[model samples]
Target: MLGVVRTLTALDRLLDVLPVLADDMRVETRFAVAEGSAFARNLADELHRCQAQVVTWDEATGKDFDLAISPSSNGPLHELEVPVVTLPHGAGHHKLRATETGVAQEVSGLSRDQLMHEGRVVPAVVGLSHPDQLAELRRNCPEAVPRAALIGDPCFARLQVSLPMREQYRESLGTGRRTLVLLASTWGRDSLFGRRGDLARELVATLPADYQVALVLHPNIWNKYDGLQIDSWTRSARRGGLILVPRLRKWQAALIAADVVVSDHGSLALYAAALGKPLLLGAFGHDEVVPGSPMELLGERARRLQPGDLRAQIDAARPVPGHRQLAELTFQDRPYQRLRTLIYQRLELPEPPWPAHPEPVDPFTP
Candidate 1:
């Protein structure tokens, strides 16, 4: 099996399922970093940490394989001869990104132009997390609908599996009894950080001693601008008791540990809501989100963060009533297992002997 990585987010999502295949002696997994995303930084380092056998994109495209899997569709997937599976790298692909020409926008992952080339579909199966996405794809890219598969979401599955470990996660973060407020942001000129970069500092300064504040930035932000730049941007906030969670690792645990999450239209918000955490949309970029996506529904129903008594807002925040609807949209209970089956089918191999149950993610560490 070959894993195609385009961004840290893609890599993060890919890592969730690769272990299922890698554990089987019958399968061999190699990683190829597709060169395109500005957020591709630190991918090599992450692959190194996993001790993954790395191959160049040139090599990946030149050679044929049993199957290729990627959580992103950004690369030249059409060039590959092998059966490719395109997976969602986030919460059900609800954002709209500009086309290559910067002239018009399409739903990020469902574009026919992105999924096909020369009047042929690229991926053998386009993996989606929900049935709603299947409908959305039909509306946006009808030609690709025949290839769509509902693979569920391994990341959200892992998050759910990690819920029982919440206290351990909190202890790791040193939040013994304090109310934890997690501020999450996606990367863009319209994200929470873009709208109010100093919100973390302001929360830290305004909230009482019984409260703990942490920031969870999207990997794109960290990579596009680098960590040194981020530290410099949040230096004062760091000094003011705001915990800047590392981009790659701690955000998951922090989300599990948080009492309330303040975020934008990022996947984290959707995940937090689905997990039944009190959520507030700190800044939502309406223009960038899909018109009728679950995220858009969330933005409509969830409370909007406002400038005021931060503590009161935190205290009064409640999980959105629409959270169950979001959860329903996510589909199955076990995603990795489903993914393993799909992969084996794609590779024309028998199922592995061992179970493919999701393991709890490691505890958060600073």
Candidate 2:
């Protein structure tokens, strides 16, 4: 209902972008739909494309099920009984009250009073990355932290499957002998660098001859603010010998191939951390979109350097000695199996086997 702001905050939910889990669980969808809204229209189109059964809540009554899911802080949270579950639309360390989707007043954004009510009421919650996450949940929105086992993030679990080989990705994206640096922008205007698409130019101008930068943009960045400038920069950079990664599938592939990832508190930093590569913090912790995701802590994990020090930092960044595992802490994997198991456990239905492989992903397509 907050339109673009909400759309940018939780596009995956807006598009109904779900992962292909093991079983064909019938997904009956309901929308607090705002007619004529561009985001609403996009959501309807995406849900149709996903072939989900769209139904109003009234139409969905009496369906035999173990649980109903909101996939966000809101979604008919009230008017339900025990065992109704929520899968927060976004992840990390922010309070539900702080998100664009968490109004706590409207059905889209549940009011604080209602949230605490639900917190004491709902049986379970899904998609928490770490055990410590719950402390904040209970501390900040005690009324909303559900009373059940916190399931690991299904999205992160699915993302944990092995990625495409670096060599294969290198050949496809043509990084050749140079080290690959992915210059990512979550919100170019508000990132620590405080400029739109200009960091790529700065990096390109200063990086050593052996390194090549790849430009990958968040959908919000290229879509809402800097499309023309991004395109122009990408083209000019490509001519000057940088690689311009394709959107969606190719972008995911580029993530796998990146030797170092640079971002200003974007999800890419989190994803790159999941990939177990060295990360370069740009925005530090400037949270223009949503403050305090688990990702905002990446500045602690990565090397913080000025724009001029990027190349040198990359050179100096080696694994942090022994026993210091990186990135594995980011995602709790097994999301496909977890959801199916939860359905079986809660609904007394049979669980499906895990997918046999790590299927290809398109970061922008959904």
Candidate 3:
């Protein structure tokens, strides 16, 4: 049995790890989530679909579990008695330097993610994707990074193997006849397509019918801005041939099917480029308050665009050498099993049979 604490994007990371744990019936999982997060209900649905129980985290509850794993640097971790393992939540991958300017501050922010939860070190060991990330952390936050464990992102492990989502992606989103384009957007006024006159609508409005646009929105956008800015474009775009990606599973499928990617400097860009997709930057990367990321190494390969000039190429942009290198830097091969192994090693549990489900029914969801 294990406990998990998730903040915003870590819900998808939790989804990635659940498949490795699913086949093991002996291991029951419980997730502790903040009561007030926007996506709490969506997470409830997702957790039920994944067959895990949920616990509402209240600081005064003082509940203790056998082991706890948190997937975010910014989770609601407080006084807990068990050994807590903190998984990477898309930060801590670059060298750090103090700065006040936007660009340098962006670089500094990567390693120095404003140590959250009252400056309490959350994890007994911090999980990392590469040794380089560890070194970067050591130079920046020596106290924390020294306990780093090189566990590649379990999410990008799918790219290390043959894609399983190709057919389903085509089935749900489209037939394979069109050139697939993925437009992944984050939320807030800082988002890529937040107030930008609907890029998906514009893409389908401008691009020829030989293309397909799949837009996977961040869950926060789905929850917080539901009937507001998100609705402004999604319904209209769907009417105009945009394939609205619903959840992380389908989002991964879209990534598998995508030939070209348009995103901000968010996790989607990192995951897409980590899987070797041609990337283009929307307005989000160029003018955002979200700290810059090492994932931008691959994002910089593409042409940056303002909201008005969203362009499409007849042929997909070729992923450069830097894309693959940064991807390899971000992901490890066989990560699900490696994460499983690490869990067993850390928690001193017996190894469970980690088998591949050739046709996993909804994979992480019911």
For TM-score, the strongest prediction is 1
Highest lDDT among the candidates is held by which one?
1
Off by over 4 Å in 3: 35-46, 49-51, 58-64, 91-120, 162-165, 195-197, 227-229, 284-293, 305-316, 353-366
Error of 2 at 251 (Å): 3.7
- Candidate 2, position 65, lDDT: 39
Tens digits of per-residue lDDT, candidate 1, 246-312, equal: 8675688999999999999899999999999999888998888888888888989999888877788
What local distance difference test score does each model get?
0.85, 0.51, 0.62
Listing every candidate in turn, what is its Cα RMSD in Å to the true structure after a full C-alpha superposition?
1.6, 5.9, 4.4
Expressed as tens digits, the lDDT of each residue in 166-250 for candidate 2 is: 5666766667788988877654445533554566766777787878788876654544544467567566666666766543234
What is the Cα root-mean-square deviation between model 1 and the actual structure? 1.6
Q: Candidate 3 clashing pairs?
A: none
For candidate 2, give the lDDT. 0.51
Q: How do the residues 16-119 of candidate 3 rate in per-residue lDDT, one tens digit apiece?
A: 66676666666677776645444556665666776767775653235446667767554345456666677765533442232345334333322445332456
